[model samples]
Target: MVMVEYMDNVKLGMLDGFLTRNHQKSLKSLFSRNKSPNANDNGDDDPSSAALNSPKSIPQLSPFANSVVSRCSKILQVPTEELQHHFDTQLPESVKELLTYARNFLEFCSYQALHILSSHPDYLNDKEFRSLTFDMMLAWESPSVETKPQDKETTCSNQEVEDEDGWSIFYSSSTNMAVQVDDKKTVGPEAFARIAPVCAAVADIITVHNLYDALTSSSDHRLHFLVYDKYIRSLDKVIKASKNALASSIENLQLTEGEIVLDVDGTVPTQPVLQHIGMSLWPGRLTLTNSALYFESLGVGLYEKAVRYDLATDMKQVIKPELTGPLGARLFDKAIMYKSTSVAEPVYLEFPEFKGNSRRDYWLDICLEILRAHRFIRKNNLKETKKSEVLARAILGIIRYRAVREAFHFFSSHYKTLLAFNLAESLPGGDLILKTLSSRLLLLNSGAAQHDLSGSPHAKWQPKLSPVSLIALTQLGFMLQKDVHLDAEAIIVGDVCVGEINPLEMAVKQSVLDTGRAEAAQATVEQVKVDGIDTNVAIMKELLFPVIELASRVQVLASWDYPCKSTAFLMLSSYFILRGWIRYILPSIFVFVAVVMLQCRHFNKGKPLEPFRITPPHNRNAVEQLLTLQEAITQVEALLRSGNIILLKIRALMFAVLPQATDRIVLLLVFMAAVFACVPLKYITLLVFLEAFTREMPYRKESSDRWLRRIREWWIRIPAAPVQLIKPDDRKKKKSLDDRKKKKS
Candidate 1:
């Protein structure tokens, strides 16, 4: 029955819940009229695909909607009246009746205008195209006068700018023009986040805000056109170069079918890449593909057979930056350590540079992007072209990241990573975004079959033109996927919608919020990181002082140095045990802790927390501190050895190293087990408590000492278990191929 249930879920897919089934057709309807829809979008005879014929009975749009329509007219080279008429005609009656009618109409115009602009070779390069599109998004935010309210800060007037940086965001929106944007005009994070991810191959929604932060980091977080233009163009240059770079080592690397090469290193003599296995080191050529890493060592002035380290398969792989040196001394931090289940040991690739490991860092970032992309693919169990699409997306993202790195020389932070999938894996709510994206990928139809626009099975998705970036790349003469082909006219439009945040964008926003909170908490932690071990120990000791004091008091009573107190404690403890009141001890402790917390909160309401006061250990020099740590470790080792010796003696008795002792101990155990099984638990506990309580009494002290001494003597006489150590098997880790023919003699 369990197996049947498991198989059902497996068939449905682990992410079945994330597949946006029955997705409403609001934005889909608006984005329906691309320059060329996918074959699956609609049949040629479909009425919905035909040119719009305005019906004058439709109601007039609001002021905001009128402005959006007018701008669309300018971009399309059509009259405002005709554009507005076309928009009203395309509006489904069911959609026109909603409160969001004007917003939907605005989205309808914006989508068509953007689609037309997408065909132009320099659309992204055009300042007006960027500004007009940004205004469309702003108009979508405040679609009509009736929907307008507070949060005036969201408008263009209060653009995100810092005066201290001698720069401001864009000016207020014009009543005539969409947005009065120019060289001085600025944009906020939200605006950039919305616009950039549309070029999904360049910016991912999960990391779009981070990418914005990266671009505007030096500009006081105010996104100026200069920075935005530079970044986009740089990324553009990177994509163009990277697409052609795949051919550099196609035959030499021998990449498998469908594998796209990401990056390669170690071609230059002055900047040779060193491969280290154990204590041996040699210069090599390293290549990274979407699936694996290949390193070919230089032998006799030529590269040898490449050793492949698989990344596409799950192998609990660990890749990180580490230091390496001659003879394994680890004196330089210019290497990457790659370890996986497929390899017997970790392999280190060192990028030798004169000063820093910038070269190494680049290799690390690109390699990790490919590694993480595959992990995401394997985690979701994606298949075929969908899998190819994911790898292609990752490949493009890395190239763009490299472009920015090369142009700006800026390294992204943990919260501001440039890689999309890498950011998703690191961000808090990113799984939901990935789930939505993965489901959306499966929605793209790659067949010759056609259906009516309204009746198409995937009509709910609206746009089927993605892997848009790859399509863009292919158009520019670079080919990554031979098995998968997308519509030639596919243009990347992200998941942004008409006056509504899509689920994927919502997840991204939430994750970015969480990331900000995480960075804040980490900042607080950084502020409190004490350097000295003695200071840390002092803090811990202060925190646990009450528990330490209680244990000391219990020890004093058990010593019986004060007979009256010891007797009273013993009787009280026994009485509590007999009444079974000790069962409530843990609950009582919890209640006490809660009360203490409340009391502290009440008293500290208007005050900051009092500083923790501790008389730290005497100040010591660095050498003295090191000596203290070593001494502590030595004491712990001593305690472990003593414990092991005691266990070994018990092992000897169990194995009958001494027949008399074994028989005695075995009978003693049988008697204890029988007592536990047959006797009432309360009576047994009372008997044990009484025996220990009276052992330190004045009358029995002498005999107790004598008995303890005898017990010690007996323990010392017991033989310990013998131990043997065996050497590990030594085999050659890697062997060269042996030819079948014998050497000529």
Candidate 2:
């Protein structure tokens, strides 16, 4: 039994050469038996009688072929009894007819299956193999039929044109029923619809077959060369048929009246005309007419209506010209905004480039001319009856143009600065200064500082100040003294001079004392006067109110000034640093380092490296090494003498300096002012430090583009350092839960 099985395996191994010959014989017998005149004449007989009348020459399969059939049956999961029954009994007439037309298709599928199984015996279990087999079955079940109408005269009138490549072109005069023009001939929309299904089917088949071929070819095992050759031929036929159908449909199209000024293929926004929803732009043929613009769909059967815009009524306004980039131009260009009383929204029409020529500007010019002519005709007709009204309209038009020009000029001059300031005021730092100052005032009023103020009128009060407030006040005082030259001593706080004290601290102290004095005076007035009026509280209000007002005003000004100061400091620092190091000193250092590193190794080793070594030596030992080093040095000297290397080095140095040259010069001047001219660098640095540290405070958390936050994260290494790692089992459970949710969804 084992020996017999080995022999059977050897026979099945040689089945590739025999499969094709066997298939041809089987196909010939199948066709001949079905096409017999007597069998047809009998008509719908019993299967046994039909088999008896059929041709006696039944195609016999070898044992190998039978084994192949059995293997395919097993792979298809067909029952053994059903498989035997299908082979033994004759199929019904209708099935035989379908099989006769699909002979080549069935043969192709069977051969493909055989090829896959021969190479990959486990292909029966492959998902890709199952999908491909299903696709092949669907293709075989639905055959392409010529959808020609069955009128004898119409069929006779049809012209059948054939190309050298075997593409059939059928044109019937009856198909032009949809576009029955008195003076012109054209293909109707129904003609495209009739042939669209066949073209779409061919396209789908080509796509699926190509994908299958690609997937199968990418595997480790190779397909038979003939199989690929046959697939390529099938693909070429379908593609050619699709192209010919599209071309024929377009060629038969004719315009109704106007000569086509421009003809191109593009997409138009779908107009809700019938049952179809207007959701996306549909591909269509765009044609520009002398009096109107028209767009017609390329595909048929879809409930899409042709879009038409009458130049006389619909061209209400011509929008300003915009230059769309390459990608936009491919989509559509020379967009015109159009409106009509009938439609709620304005319709946008675009003229795309046709072939290599873009007639967008030409089309636009013609449209404008049409609009102008129409307007002129209407005005001429009305001029005799309404002369005064026409004159008023002309004056209004002139006034409108002049006003628009002046408004544009005004905006161009002043709008940019105002826009920048408005944007700056919206940032978090703008509100931050106000909040910080308000919170500080509230703290001073509510804390023990209020009690200290109530104790004695002569006692001086000094409230604690936040670092941010202190830095802001110091910078403000420095600016006031230097720029405005205002003496801080003009504003007195308690018994001390303002210039001799911290202004913010003094303001907070005064506000706290004022609140305390007001409260105490109110209590005393309620006890003594009974009129709810206190003289001390009123007096204290006048004296201490200005201090709080000044502090509030300073906070508002600081918000505006803080950003400008920080920007100026950064610009100056960058300038000074680049000029001092990057431009001149850094390049010099890089050159010196390169020269030292490249030269020092040879000096220390007493012999040059391979690329710079000398060919020979006058003596052996130490003298030889010294002489070789001299030769290497001479080579280096010769290389430097060529001037190319020196020029390159010079260029490298200049390349580093050119980009930052202007900025460095400007910053150098600012740096000089800050260092030598007493521009208050310490105050700027202190303010910068305080701002950076408090950048993430509660009030400032709304800031989006936080460079300070990024800097802090980088310094800390891990932004979320306290986060815990998930265990492997927990991660698996989470993934499983997610998958289950996805399945349910």
Candidate 3:
């Protein structure tokens, strides 16, 4: 955190520029809708956003609060009046003073309501449930016009200091207040995480902040009601379309039981999916299921037999974005390359877009999600319905991500992606989150765990059985696994209790905080990168100047550039090596470096690091650089080819490809082994040392040259093994393309 603050100083201008750009863009968008708007985010309106646009729609509690409360009532199955009465009666007087405190009330109602709704089979698919819950988030962002200002003034003017507990100390510091709320009444990440997960379909508590960050990234990393609403609405459409698609896939694609269709493309002739198998490209309909990828090649007027790409089972699957082009030349970066032990070769699924590869990226993300989810299942060894729960969670998260990407036309960056598995993989301390999730999953049923967690229940706090999310998905008609029979009396509570933080949630929060620091650190790193190869090399050289100077002296000694120094240095090194003091010399150098660092730290206490000074190397033009590169490449290629040929000859000798060569190599190896057996290692080392030491001596020069020449002649006489190249069956590919060209012609 301290380092992040320091890094922030390094990239303050960059962050400011970023926020300013997004802020202006957001303002412009909102201004087009509203006569006058807030400076922070461009709020959306289906209910709350709609109210924000019209001054007349403002009410006593504001449509935002009313919408939230109304949704809460439905979840609680209580009337709105009774809900408000409960809130008024149950909450603390100090907390209930402002609309901001209403978030706590909303959390209470929404969480409990979510717990109840999560059990309903149709809750995830229910359009009204999604609309209401997301509307609650939108409403949470910007409240009633009257209440918003009042709350803002109340927060700012409340200087009445009360540190009744050690809490008020947390509220102020260098500037009057330790922590202060911003004037802009936007929903915070914490609030989003707390409320968004009310519907398992909306968010998972573990990755809610990431989802929020993804949803809000374009609006200066502030949640906008518009983005949230569009995302939820898009998700609703996607879910419904997927359900509809199942009916059609049932006849053609024999989907595995509990396999929910995720997405399908290439149904239209104009936007056909191009599938490349060992170079052959075919247009086809590609369907992504909960478990695998199904490709049905378009043939004659009918689709050929569907090719299933297993994602659920472990077949050493590797899915990544790769370049694909006509004839498999890899000229275009618009394909998902899938390679697995199950498939004969890598399959390229190309989504042709004239511009950026959004289509490819989309497919890549969804496919990886299923891949990673199954991996998680495998890694954790989840069985039966537990597998279903994990799979369903992944399914919902992907749906949410799809909704956001398609609706907002914006992609969440690495740290803020919505896919749970992807987010976990990318986030720092993410393994801890996964571990916590594994523990959480163990509490899915039975009201109690049978496993001996160190022997007794009274000795340790046991986790409660709460699988509301799984229940929600099951109710939504996904039917992920047949093994899970929901207990009617199972405790319907959130993974997180009202006043307590779940271990998984805490892990997520920690990861989120670490991610913020990582982003800040990355920003500073980006700022410090010197442009151009010459400049960067110059900086590197300057940083390593001491090491370079030492190396130069050693080089001078080795080449005997100065006879006196060379003789003295050689004597000293040889004495050290012979005396077995070489080991201590490196340790001594390490100690010296450590002392220097500590001394520097002591001398420069409370000060910044001194900037290294360096002058860039002379710049070379393209032609000069190219000429140098060509010369280097020529030398390197010759060396590599020579090395490879020698390796091949050695391989041939080992495999007895040639009888004489193999017999000679075997004899030589046997002799060497006999010598090694007979001789001590010390004698061998001494002999090697003496040979290297005397190689350039005048008396031994002739003999050494004769031996080297003989060895070179012998090596030249040894023949390289015969090699053959295997070309894949690409005739079908050529034929396919040739036919297509002819048809076009």
- Scored by lDDT, the top model is 3
Ranking by TM-score: 1, 3, 2
Q: Rate the local accuracy (lDDT) of all candidates.
A: 0.65, 0.34, 0.67
* TM-score (C-alpha, index-matched) for candidate 1: 0.76
Evaluate residue 581 in candidate 2 and report its C-alpha lDDT on the 0 to 100 scale: 38
Please name the candidate that would achieve the greatest TM-score relative to the true structure: 1
Candidate 2's C-alpha runs over 4 A off are: 1-244, 247-669, 672-687, 690-745
Better of 1 and 3 by lDDT: 3
lDDT of 1 by residue, 1-745 (tens): 2332232222122112212222233322322234332222444553322222211222455555555566564344344555455445533354455686766666655754564455444444444554455555455555666755223221333234535533233311121111333423456776566555554444665667777777666666766554554566566666555556566667777877666666778878887889889998989888888789999898898899888999889999898999998888789999999999898989999998988888888788778888888887887787765676677678777877776786668686666778878777778777877887776666544421122345332232333424555454454455556744543223233354334465667777788888889998999889767767788888888899999999999878877899999989998989988998877889999999999999999988989767677787878899998998999899999999999999999999989999988998989999999999999888788888877878878888899899999989988999999987644432222221122233332
Relative to the true structure, candidate 3 reaches a TM of: 0.70
Ranking by lDDT: 3, 1, 2
Query: Runs in model 3 with CA error above 4 Å?
Result: 1-106, 116-184, 446-463, 481-491, 516-544, 600-614, 617-623, 645-745
Q: Cα deviation of 252 in candidate 2 (Å)? A: 5.5
Estimate candidate 2's alpha-carbon lDDT, on a 0 to 1 scale.
0.34
Cα error, residue 365 of model 3, in Å, equals 1.4
Report model 2's TM-score to 2 decimal places.
0.17
TM-scores for all predictions: 0.76, 0.17, 0.70
Q: How well is each residue in 279-342 modelled by candidate 2, as lDDT tens digits? A: 3344555544334555665567442445666654433544333434233343444555545564
